[model samples]
Target: MNDNNKDDKTLNHSRRQFFKISTALTAVALTPSYILKAADDNMDDKIAELFEKRDLNIEVNGIVHTLSIEPRVTLLDLLREQLKLTGSKKGCDHGQCGACTVHVNGQRVLSCLSLAIMQDGKKITTIEGLAKGDELHPMQAAFIKHDGFQCGYCTPGQIMSAVACVREGHANNEDEIRSYMAGNICRCGAYPNIVDAITEVKQKGGTI
Candidate 1:
């Protein structure tokens, strides 16, 4: 082939390859949308088939929460999604981190690990319910005063555990407080401040 003719042919091949790659990329991007739409449609049908309207009577904070919750809903999901109380965070859904800690019948329990049905007719106190009108709980106040949190992702759990620790008389000393709160991990390494908050609350005779 002539040199000019060969160069022209190479340019044409490159243009065709570029178009082919562009088309492939477009299809690849659309594939995820199509799959997501199909999955959403399937979920809608399953929800309609499985979900039955029923009343769920449970006490949240101090008031009775009467609403319908799916049988498969976890207590943590119910609290955050259904009730719109997102104070109890979902750190470790497997009950490892105490982020989803809340008072169930006056005892600290991992809300993520509990079923909504199991907490029926029991008193539930979330972090939102800890404060009284405008006054924060002693632990919450201590947390703020001592700057017990860095990222604040683990602060809620730390505060909740601190409340329980004091109420259960586990915060008799710094070492005991640390040992008791060892279950609730803080990625920010705010253990000293957390222990200080717990100690302050304990000194004041605070109860959850």
Candidate 2:
């Protein structure tokens, strides 16, 4: 009877060991599926990120640039952040102050209100691009001669708009210049000097 009891104990220990090994094997087999699913999820995220970015090619300051950017990026952000062209001010990003004015296809548009994706394959001109190698543009020179700015924060936008004003034949008289340039606000009250600068450029009638 002692030998039979010993045999029963051995059988129980063997059963316990067998169950432990079986459970470990099952867990090991299931872990690979979970890992594979996690890997697939990560791969899907990577694919989504890739799809969200788009290729953009634009010409700025007479130079062509190719960029990969998100669709929601603004033209001001693209110019200042990516291209390092910070001449355009960001005051009143809501398009009320006209501080971010720039030329698109020879027409003035608020850079903050414009999207970068919409400007793909289009021409853009900033204040930095307005000058030649060592000579400033005619409008810039006139602004310097007339002191059209006070703090100089709004000078870039002002100069850009002034150039457009002359090019579009809107600088005929003081009232017209004021009416056309009403979008640009000078907190320092430099309206008189700004008018003088635009008038000088228009009288000269040289290439703006």
Candidate 3:
């Protein structure tokens, strides 16, 4: 009777182990597809977010452009990277050197510090746009005449600020031009020539 009892107990334990193994195998086989589907869904969402772009419509150099840009992109990057307008140099990206200066709605601004999204429906003027088909703007002509640049890396920003200085009526004299154009740093020490360019433009009433 005791032997019969022991055999029955062993049979029950074997059945339990078999059922547990079968359940685990079923779960393992079925869970992979579900887990893979979940991972695929997550990857799709991440790809969509990574490629998200905002529509941008702004006039550049008298021509209007419709662009798709990321929110974190700066105007400088949009101009240089997307639009192929590289006249504006990326110097002192911190907005301290003023090398990324450009005109927004006729007001000089630091493009490196300005976001492209915020400039929708605005007029932007870079150094490339400062000239017509074959004629240069008065400011450009004056800079050339006065030899306002040395290495020319900072010339674009210097010219833009100089134009603004004249338009704002801040180019009355040497001191005023220096004070107003202080934001632009010409490492070549072309301060005197820059002042000369601005003063000439002011005296001649140069067209901005």
Candidate 4:
């Protein structure tokens, strides 16, 4: 080939290689910026949530407590996990079971379905709070007397609901007691005994 033709071929090859290298570098630079930005945004969101917690001030069973908890924390978790009040069982965390029943502002509340952060400045009563120091509440005593529980896993919630039933004036009769206490489910089938206990408590008529 002539020298002029050879020089022209070399120049064309060099130009092609330069464009290839520039395109590769540009893609590498541009692709990483988008990927890195997405990664950074995800990391920022996780970091923000990791330190996110709200202050909660509330009373439980006549004792006031100040706590800091995540907004997603449920009242049942706050009692069992944080405050160590495990009497309110965690059965059926979806609120189907009554094992997590407790009192919030004098009404029966399903703790598992309730958010602790939303209960700020509210009064909560767990099964552990039903008794006065070493003295069982009347409903607790009645439950024992009537053998209202067998496995006893559902007893705490049962007793709590029972107290609420009597206080709510729903225990006027056996049928009424059964109707109000229906929310509490005893796997051992202690409904009859539970009804008996609540009936006795209601009939006593002193202080529920």
Best by lDDT: 2
Clashes of 2: 0
- After superposition, candidate 1 runs with Cα above 4 Å error: 1-54, 206-208
Instruction: Compute the lDDT of residue 185 as modeled in candidate 1.
Output: 86
Residue ranges of candidate 2 with Cα displaced over 4 Å? 1-51
Higher-lDDT candidate among 1 and 2?
A: 2
For model 2, residues 90-141, the per-residue Cα lDDT tens digits are: 9999999888999999999999999999999999999999999899999999
Model 1: per-residue Cα lDDT over 57-124, one tens digit each: 79998889866565778999999998999988999899999899888898888999898977778999
Pairs of colliding residues, candidate 2: none
TM-score of 2: 0.77
Relative to the true structure, candidate 1 has a C-alpha RMSD (angstroms) of 18.3
- Candidate 4 off by > 4 Å: 1-51
How do the residues 84-183 of candidate 3 rate in per-residue lDDT, one tens digit apiece? 9999999989999999999999999999999999999999999999888899989899889989988999999998888888989999999989999999
List pairs with backbone clashes in candidate 3. Answer: none
lDDT of each: 0.79, 0.85, 0.84, 0.83
Question: Clash number for every model?
Answer: 0, 0, 0, 0
Could you give me the TM-score of model 3 versus the true structure? 0.76
